[model samples]
Every structure is written in C-alpha cells, then in structure tokens.
Target: MRKLVIAISMLAFAGSAAFADPILDRQALMKERGKIVGGLAKVAKGEDPFDAAAVLTQLQALQANAEKLDVDALFPAGSDAGDTTAGPKIWEDMAGFKATEDKYLADVKAATAAAPGDVDALKGQINTLGGDCGTCHQTYRVKKG
Candidate 1:
C-alpha cells in the first residue's frame, strides 16, 4: 500500500499538468503521512497488519522525492502556476525547511528498525515526525487559503 502511494506521488510529480487543489493536496498529504506512519506503529504491535515491508521499502523513496520536492511549487515564483497560499518565507527560510525534511528522513530511517514487532517504540518516533510536518505547515501554509 505504501508502495502504491509512493508510486502515485511519483506519477503526480512527474506529470506536467498534475495540479492538485492546494488546500485539498495539503490535507491529503497530512492524512497520508498519518496513515503510513500509523501503519508502521500497528506492525510494531505485532498485529501482522498492513504491509510493513512496503512501508519500509518506500521510506527511502519518499525521502528521496521529499528531499527534492519543492513545496513552494504550490507557490511557484515566475511560472504561470498561479497564486498559491504558501508564504514567501519558504524560500527565505529554505535552509531551515530542508533541515526539517532531513531530520524527518533521519527519524524515519532510525525508526524503521522497529518494524514487524517494534511498534511501540516506533509510535514514539512517529509523533516526532509529525512535529516536522506541523512545523512546516504552520510556517508555510495559510490556514484558510
């Protein structure tokens, strides 16, 4: 399932006209993150549910795309992508933003070992990952845009 989602993410990024509604896209990404990370936690509980292998496999893939992903594309500079709700501080504060993402990937990599039977510990790590998501959203996304 994680692999399928990653494949979709990839296809969405690659397609030239794949412009998802900004607000809806943001919600979808946040929800998807919750589901995938939560799925890892369930595996840690020894529930034998959700394909942990797929999650593990896509962690690196997601991170790779994430590293290159410009959330600001939701608010492109010179192109005709139209006005986005993302703030200009995203570019002004890019270093911090990339660090946030790097730390997210790092956390996911460390937490991956908890898979198949380490859900509890992974759950703890999962919340920390949410911190990154929350921080960026708070800084970059407009609440009602």
Candidate 2:
C-alpha cells in the first residue's frame, strides 16, 4: 500500500510538472521583463537616481526580451489552463495578438534608439514604452487575484 501510494504521488507530480512547465516558463520571462520595467519606472518617477548607463542596459534587455518572445510557442493550446493571466482572446484572435506584440516590439525598438540621455528624456521614452505595455495588457491579459 505504501509503495502504491508513493507511485501515485510520483505520477501526480509528473503530471503537474508537465502541466505547469509552459506557464512557469512564461511567468519567468514576464518576471524578467517586469524587473527591467520596474527599474525604468523608478528612474522615470525620480524614485531612483537617473543613471543613463543603467537605463540603456535595461532598455537593451527589454528590446532583447521583446525580440525573443515567441508568442505562439510560449502560448500553446493548453498552456493557459494553469495559473496564467493570459486571456482567451490571445488564442481566439491570434492576428490581433500578433499585431499587439509587434507594436510592443516596435515601441521598445524606438525607445532603445531614443536612449534617453537624462531623466526628462527617459520619462518620455518610458511613457511610450509603458503605453505599449498598457495597451497590450488591457487587450490580451486577464487580471489575476
């Protein structure tokens, strides 16, 4: 009976790991992006000292993440069945989702090019980048509790 219970627990664990793999991967990606965005926001809000070099690094990281984001693969058919905040519209309206992703990438590219030299300039670029994030989230993401 103990052996049987152990086998069942192992099987359950394996099943859960398989189910959560994609969601965990996507969550990690989003968390990295969030950290970069949070730093940018702090600088923009004057909560942190404006370091141009750091801003450039963060922008570069953001741009790279945007480029690396593979929406289709990252968001597979059953990937959203877990604890994801992604809305059903992402899969339902794939074209629109792709368009929103493209817009965000474009905004990040533009912000990277702008490379704000000071806090004031950074604020404007942050606003543009943040707007892209806002628009995409509002349309494609569901708020989680």
Say which candidate scores most in lDDT. Answer: 2
**TM-scores for the candidates:** 0.54, 0.82
lDDT of each: 0.58, 0.86
Residues 1-145 of candidate 1: C-alpha lDDT, one tens digit per residue: 9999999989877566433555445445555666665555455465655465665664544454344444565434432234444555666777776677667767666655554334455456656666777787788655553
TM-score of 2: 0.82
Q: Tens-digit lDDT track for model 2 on 1-145?
A: 9999999999688646542466786777788898999999999999999988899999999998888677876788887687889899988998998998899899899989889999999998888878888987999899988
Assess the local accuracy of residue 52 in candidate 2 as a C-alpha lDDT between 0 and 100.
84
Candidate 2 to native Cα RMSD, angstroms: 9.7
What candidate 2 gets wrong by more than 4 Å, as runs, is 1-20
> lDDT (0-100) at residue 4 of candidate 2?
100
* Lowest-sum lDDT 10-residue window in model 2: 14-23
Each candidate's clash count: 1, 0
